[model samples]
Target: MRVPLALLMIATPLAAAKRPTVAQLQIQVKKLTEERDSLKQRLAATDSLQQDLVAAQQARDQAKADADAARKEVEQLKANLKANASGGDTLLKDLEAARKEAEASREELAKVKAENAELRQQVAAAPREGDLVMLTRDVQPARPLNLNRATPHIKASGFFASRPTGVVVVNVLVSEKGEVLDARLLQGLPGDSPDAKAANEACVQSAKNLVFDPATSKDGNTRFKVWQGVGFYLD
Candidate 1:
């Protein structure tokens, strides 16, 4: 018997198949759908992880840069501290040296002051040594009594009726050539009274009028600066 072509085609698929269970087909379809969803989730998770790693690396790089800047600043501070310490030491040494110099100057000034005081004392103690030496050389020898010198300046008026009236003392400095340089009354009656003034004047005149033999030194040379004191006594 000859079969139709359409029926042959349909019958051919049926002849090759073992009969399929409906439960097995359903299980296979479920397994394939789960595998596709699992693949999509894994891809999304990988992308998120890559993004987090990049942010962490950027933070680490910034921290490293900040650490380098801090280290440089610390080094600079250390250098500045060392420089200041050295300068302070130098200043201390200079101060000590200046102190010593000032002390020495003060000591020297004290020594100078002491020397000046001693010099002033010496000057005050012996004021007239030079004057005395000159006077000694000028004293004339008035001894050996030349009493017969007929005096024109002295006259006896039959001796005074009353006790002689006036007495005076005068000091005179004779110049180098034996001329009276100065005459002054040292002690006498005090007054503007004519009698007292006359007496004083007379004494001064007498001193000036008197002449001495030229004074001589031990070597017989004429001396300078003779001084004399003349006293007028009433008896």
Candidate 2:
């Protein structure tokens, strides 16, 4: 059928407008592909980030465990050091106490030695007399009549000058070193004489050489500490 020319021309322009060009279609396909690929890449990157986060968390846990172990070790070391320090302090205190005790013992020993030395000197410095006899000790205790005839004469000089006139009493204690330690007047004679003191001194001097009989316990034995009183007068 024959178409009108004006209608054909308008229909031809409409068809041309509806159809797309090759270059424009290609551009649109490229843009759509790029957008799909970009979305896939973004999902992959998100997964990688999740894995990194998990690894970091694990590392943090391990670090915490290591720190705890280190802390425990330090605490144990501190405890050990404290114990050692306390033990050392006790040992040092014991050593000091021992040293002080040793010093005190040394001082006591020195004091004992000094006392022994003094006793020795006293014994060595005592007077010596061989000619003088121990008349009172040697005389027979039962019968003693002659006063002037005694070997060691008891002279009535000094405080008892009235010879053979009155009686005098004296107290005496002898030491271990054969020396007169104490002498005192128990009673004085009535006469004004220095003889009593002289007689006492003579007795004391003669008593120094008095030999003692061996002593024993409760058994019947000769005793050493012997005491006697004597009186001398002119006939």
Best by TM-score: 1
TM-score of 1: 0.33
Residue ranges of candidate 2 with Cα displaced over 4 Å: 1-162, 165-185, 214-216, 220-235
lDDT at position 223, candidate 2 = 23
For residues 1-235, what per-residue lDDT tens digits would candidate 1 score against the true structure? 1111110001122223576533333334334433432344335434554565555455445545544554554455456556787676655555455455545545554554565565456435432311222223233422112112311132233344222233355555655455566767654546655545555565566556655443445554545443444444432
Which residue pairs does candidate 1 place in steric collision?
none
Query: lDDT of each prediction vs. the true structure?
Result: 0.43, 0.38
Clash number by candidate, in order: 0, 14
RMSD of 2: 68.7
Poorly placed runs, candidate 1 (over 4 Å): 1-166, 190-192
Give the best candidate by lDDT.
Answer: 1
| Model 1 residue 70 lDDT score | 45
lDDT of 2 by residue, 43-89 (tens): 54356545655554555555455545545554555566567886766
